[model samples]
Structures are given as C-alpha cells and as structure tokens.
Target: MAVAVAVAALTLVPLAYVLVSVVAVGPAEAARLLWRPRVGELLRNTVGLTVAGCVASAVIGTGAAWLVERTTLPGRRLWTMLMAAPLAVPAFVNSYGWVSVTSAVEGFAGAVLITTLSYFPLVYLPVAAVLRGMDPAFEDMSRALGNGPWRTFFRVVLPQLRPAVLGGTMLVGLHLLAEFGALQSLRFPTFTTAIYDQFESTFNGPAATMLAGVLVLSCLLLLVAELRFVGRARVARVGAGVARAAVPHPLGSALPVTVLGMAALAVLALGVPLGSLAYWLVVGSSTAFPLGMLAAATATSIGLGAAGAVATCVLAVPVAWLSLRRPGLVSRVLERSTYIAGSLPGVVVALSLVTLSIAYLPTVYQTTALLVAAYAVLFMPRAMVSLRSALAQVPPEFDDTARVLGARPAGVLWRVTLPLVVRGLGAGAALVFLAVVTELTATLLLAPIGTTTLATEFWSNTYGLAYGAAAPYALLMIVISAPAAYLLTRESRRTVPGR
Candidate 1:
C-alpha cells in the first residue's frame, strides 16, 4: 500500500506542477491566460488533429486487420509484420521522410497523415487480437442466417470490435495529444508545441503550465468518454465447444485487387521512409555520414532505452498488482492517476521534474537517475497496461491455492504468478524501450550535459538541413526498434481460438 501510494504521488508530479503554478498566480490570472485567443487557436489545431488522426487510424487499422486476419490474403504473418513496421518509425521520422521527398507536407494535412501512419498500429494490434480470438461463432451465426459478407461484418463483427477499438483509439488520442516532434517538425502548432514554446521562452511561467492543465483536461475528457463508450463489456465466450479460426473469406474475384491494395499500403507505410533513408545514405552528395558519432549515439540510445524499459516495468508492477490483486477504489484511482502522465507532453513532464529537482533534490539534477525516473513516470502506463492484462489472466484462484498449500505471498508470486506473467513483463519492457529510443522532446531537455541519443542526433541534424547526415541515425533507430515491433506483433497475434 505504501509502495502504491508512493508511485501515485510520484506520477502526479506533472499535475502538481500545473496546480502549483496556477495557484501561484491566483485563479483569475490563470483563467485569463487560458482564455486568450492564442489558447483558442491551439485548441482548434490540437482538437482537429486529434479527431482527424483518430478517424484515419480507425479506418486504416481496422481495414488492415480485417484483411490480414479474416480474408484469404497470402503471407498473413508477413503482412501483419509489414503493417506494424511503421510503429518502429517514429512519427517525426515519417515527417522527415515525407518532407524530404516533397516540401508540400507542412500543415494540418501533414500532421494527420504522419500521425495516422505512425499510430494506426495501436488500433491495429488490439483489434486484430480481439478478432483473432473472437469465438467466430458469433460471426458464423450471422453468416449462416443469410447475411452477406458486408452486412455480417457491419452488424456482427463491428459491434464486437467496439470495446477494443475504443481502447486503442483512446491510446492513440492520448499519444497525439502529447505529440511534439512530429507537429513541430511539420510546422503545425498544437497545444503541445505551444506549451514547449512557452517553456523555452524567457518568461515561461503560468502560461505553459496553463496549457498543460488544459491538455490534461482534454486527456481526462477522453478517459471519461472511453469509460462511458466502452462501459461494461463482457467479452468472453460461454460454451462447451472449443473456439476455432473463422473460415477465411475467400478473395476469389478480388485476389489481384487485394494484392494491389496491400502493396500500396506497404509502399506508403514502410517502403517510402526506408527508400528515402537509403537515398540519403547512398546518393545524397552532401550527406556526411559520421560513423563514430553514429555509433556512440547508438550505444547511448540503447543503454537509455534498455534502462528505461526495465525501470518503468519495475515501477509498474506494484501499481498493476494493486489494481488487479487488491482491486478497490484506492487502487483504481492510483492506476488512473498514473495514466495522467500519458496525456502530458514530455516537455511538461521534464519541466515539472526540473522545478521539483532544483528546489528539492538538487544533488540529482541532470543526472542519469533523474532522466530514468522521468522516463518511468512518463511511460509507466504502457508497462502498467501490459502487466495488468497479464495479471488479469492469472486467476486469483491460483494464488489462493498456492497460499493454501503452505506457500507465502512472496513464494506464490515468485513460483506461480510471476512465471505466468513473465511474458507480459517482457512485453511491457519492450514497449517502453521502443518508446524511449524514439522519444525526442523529454530526452532533449532532461538528458545530462553532453548526452546525445539517436533521436536527438537525428533531430539536430535534420533541423540543420543535414538530412543526409541524419539518415543514418534515423535508419538505425528504426532497425533497433524493429525487434520490439515484432514482439508486439507476436503478442497481438495471440488470438488463439482457445486461450
């Protein structure tokens, strides 16, 4: 209980910063700053991007999942892996690639496009898993009742997809709300970019914190909508008969068309960025490939990514355990509070840490420990979700039985529960590692003096119009994150007909 309470308190640091900053100036001043025209403009851009990205991601992700999981598309595993490859390419990199090819991608359209490409995987992975695991009995019944393919999909499959889709969309919205590098690179100002701008300016005080507070409110609205929209789903089959794979809908007449569509998606999602990188590597005459610098950056990125993953997962376990094992209002609130960090941009979290560290823990300022703690606080929800899912599958009965058989709590955790959820722990770590390596804004601010990761190097080089020089680091970031992306794919593919 103490541990969980401590974790929640730590996670609320950003919120605390906002609250403290607001109170310092009094409520009327806070209200005036928030009501400014600039604030209104930022809200429009942020909300527009969020809605557009969510819609596009929904369409693309669900369509791709249906094609790979339900249709008779050859190379199902290969297609799934290819579609997920975009997740390895951060949205900022995608913008870099697109802008390098043509200078036209520099506005709202660009932000939506890049974010959808980068985030559709969030929607794809979950919906795919649900579909893969779906007893197919429901779908089969609809088809047997004389409904056509389109009707069956709309009436039967889509309703069942609602909960998973809502959860995935919620995640995508949260990430989009906190996005910085992509929108900043695209020259599209949203609340997140404005928040960063305020912080970077000479008088970054109440205004930046105010923007963060509004962003946090936006996140809370999303959370409430998700709870209401995805309320109380009973997503389990009740039958003695075993579940099996739904018969693949034969793409008899549309085989060539399906292949072409898949090819188009693959080209747009994976090939374009990769081809651009290859161009810079081989053909760009001005490209300055700094081999030694790239290597050092790669090493630093891996170290930080690995450390963040492990640390985030370790911090997340107690939170997940309380939410799952203890299961009460306190645990639930703590879990939700940790999730608030998800809605905060890295800059907000970093600035909050800066304020707290300078005033309190000055000794640890700008240290590796401080940076890692920031990573844990910012990305803990990813680990928490994975761990919670894993824990949910471990029936409480198993723990009870182990305890009754002369085992203590620690022994049961070490012997039974931990072993069962070990894969989940690994998955959680992989998720955080992938996120940390591609992370830009927070890393830029909180990293110790002279510390440079692949992301920072890429951003710096690209920002200076050294696109060719940035190519190597960008490519390497994608390469390093590919294995983690594949792990996520395999994890999502666990739609065993019978769990």
Candidate 2:
C-alpha cells in the first residue's frame, strides 16, 4: 500500500506542477492566454484530430480483428502479424515516411491517416484477444432466433466487445492528445504542438504550463466520457461451461474484396513507411550510414528502453496488486492517479520534471535517473493496464493456499504470485519498452548530456530536413521494435483446440 501511494504520488508530479504553475500565472493572465483566437483554433484542431483519429483507428482495428479472428480470412496468422507490424513504426516516423514520399499528405487528413495507421493496433490487439476467447454460444443463439449476421453482431457480439472497443479508443484518444512528433511533422497545430512551441520557441514556462493545464483538462474529459460509456454493466462471461472457440464466419463471394482490403491496410500501414525508409537509403542525396553513430544510438535506445520498462513495470506491480487485492476507493484513486501523467504530453511531463529537479534537487537534474522517472510517469499506465488484467486472472485462492503452506508474504509473492503473472510482466515490460524506445519529446528535453537515442537522433535530422540521414535511425527503430511487435501478436492469440 505504501509503495502504491509512492508510485501514485510520483506519477502525480507533472499534474501537480501543471496546476501549480497555472495558478501561479494569475487567472486573468491565464484567461487572456486561453481566450484568444489562436487558442480556440488550436482547441478545434486538437479536438478534431483526436476525434477523427480515434474513430478511424477503432473502425480499422476492430474491422481487421474481426476479419482475422472471426472470419475465414486466409492466412489469419500472417495477417495478424501484418496488422500489428505498424506498431513497430513510430507515428512520427510514419508521418516522415508519407511526407517524404509526397507533399500531398501534410494536413489534417494526413495526420488522421498516419496516426490511425500507427495506433490502431492498440485496438486490434485487445479486440482480437476478446474475439478469440469469445464463446460462440451467444451468436448461435441469436442466429437460431433468426437474427441476421449484422444484426446479431450489433446486438450480441458488439456489446460484449464494448469494453475492449472503449478501452482501445480511449487509449487512441489519449495518444492523439499527447501526440507531438506526428502532428508536428504534418504541420498540424494542436495543444501539444502549441505547448511545445511555447516552450521551445518562446521559452515561456508560465504560458506553456497554462496550455498544459488545458491539455490535462481535455484528457480528464476523455477519461470521464469513457467511464460514463463503460458504466457499471458487466461485460464478462456470465455462466461457465467449457468456453469454446468461435467459428470463423465465411466470407464466401466477398473473399477477394476482403483479402484486397486487408492487403491495402497492410501496404498502407507497413509498406509505405518501410518503403520510404528504403528509398531514402538508396537514393536520397544525404543518405549515408555512419555505423559508429548508428550503433551507439541503437545501443542507447535499447539500454534506456530496458531500464524504463523494468522501472515502469516494477512500479506498476504494487499499484495493480493493491487495486486488485484491496479494491477500495483509495486503491482505485491511486491506480487512476497513475494514469493522469500518461495523458499529459511528454513535453509537459519533461518540463515539469526539469523545473522540479532544478529547483529542489539540482544534483539529479538532467540525470538518467530523472529521465527514467519521466519514462515511468509517462508510461506507467501501459504497465498498469497489463498488470491489472493479469493480476485479475489469477485467483486469490492460490495465494491463500501458499500462505497456509507456511509461505511468508514475500515468499508467496516471489514463488506464487509473480510466477503466475510472469506473462503479464513480460507484456507490460514490452509495452513500456516500446514506448520508451519511441519517445521523442521527453527524451529531447530530459536526456542527459551526450546521450543519443534513435528517437532523438531521428528527430534531430528530420527536424533539419535531412530525411536520408534520419532514415537509418528510423529503420533501426523499426528493426529493434519488430520482435516486440511479434510478441504482442502472440500475446493477443489465444489457442483454440484446432485452427
């Protein structure tokens, strides 16, 4: 419980900083900053992109999952890998790919397309997992009552899928809110980009923090809306028998079209960025691989990713344990608090840490420890979500049995509890590692002197319009992330007795 509280308090630092900083800016000054036409335009752009991106991702992800898991789409396993492959490419890198190919993809439309391609996997993975485990009994019952396929899906399967869909879309929305690199590359102006501009271009801490406060409010609204939609309704399986695998729905005459659609999705999501990177490598004027720099960046990114993943997952364990084991208002609040920092833009979190560190703990300022803490604060929710799900699946009776057999709490956790949720630990660690590897804005602000990760290296070159030089870093990020993406695909797969 104490550990959970400490973790929650650490995660709350950025939010606390934003609020305190905003208050320090007089209300009248804050109002003046927020009420202008520019602020309104940014709000509109941010909200528009976030809404469009989340909806498009949900549709694409959910549809693809249905094809892979519920329908007789050929090469289900291959398609699963292809669908999840986009995740290996960071959103900024995706935007860079498109922008490099043609100037056409440069505004709202492009932003939506790039982000949707990058983040839809968040939806697809969970939804696919649910579909794999979903009992076909309900669908069969609905069919026996003479309901049509679409109708049955809408009424029965879709409702059961509500939780996954909502969770996926909510994550999409938050990512969109905090998205900076992709949006900036596409030349879109949103709160995140605006805040970055305020900080970097103007060095106006008060103004930047004020903008952060608004962004935080937007995140809160999103969370509230998701909770409201989720409500108290139980989406879990009600009665227990041997849960059987859902039969694949036949596409019949639509097979070609379905196959073509999935192919297009794969090409758009994976092909374009990868191909663009290849193109730059082969033909771009500035293309050159400095193996020394490349090796150093790759090693740094891997090391930082490993460190951040381990730290984030370690912090997540206590919070998830308390939430599942205790289940009360305090535990709920602590768990939820960990999520708040995640919704803040990486720049906001980074800047807050910079301020807090410089003022109170100058000794740790700009240290790798500070950067890892920032990673933990920014990505804690990823670890928490996985851990909570994993922890929930393990019955407390096992812990009781272990305790009864003379195992102490520490022994029980080490021997019994941790072993049971080891898969979750791996999943959570992979997720945090992925985020840490791709993180840019926070890395830009928080990385210690002389440290260069792939994300930062890529961003520096791209920011300078050296697409060719950036390609190696981008490609390396994709390569490093591939195994983790494959792991995610495997995690989403639940074994059915046969095919």
- In the range 1-499, model 1's lDDT, one tens digit per residue, is 7888898999999988887887897889888888888988999999999999988898889998999999899999998898878889988888888888987889999888888888998788767877787777787788889998899889988877876677678778888999998888899999899988887775577788888888989988887787678654445554566677788989999989988998898888788788888888888766776788988999999999999999898888878887777877888888778888888999989888998999999999999988998999888877876776567545577778898999987788779888777877877788789899998888999999999999999999888888888888999999899999999889777753223
Q: Assess every candidate by TM-score.
A: 0.93, 0.94
User: How does candidate 1 score on lDDT?
Assistant: 0.84
**Count of backbone clashes, every candidate in sequence:** 0, 0
- Please provide, for model 2 over 163-187, each residue's C-alpha lDDT reduced to its tens digit, 9 standing for 90 to 100: 6788778878888999999989999
Over the full model, what C-alpha lDDT does candidate 2 score relative to the true structure? 0.87
Candidate 2 minimal-lDDT segment of 10 residues: 231-240
Clashes of 1: 0
Show pairs that collide, candidate 1: none
Candidate 1 is scored at a TM of: 0.93
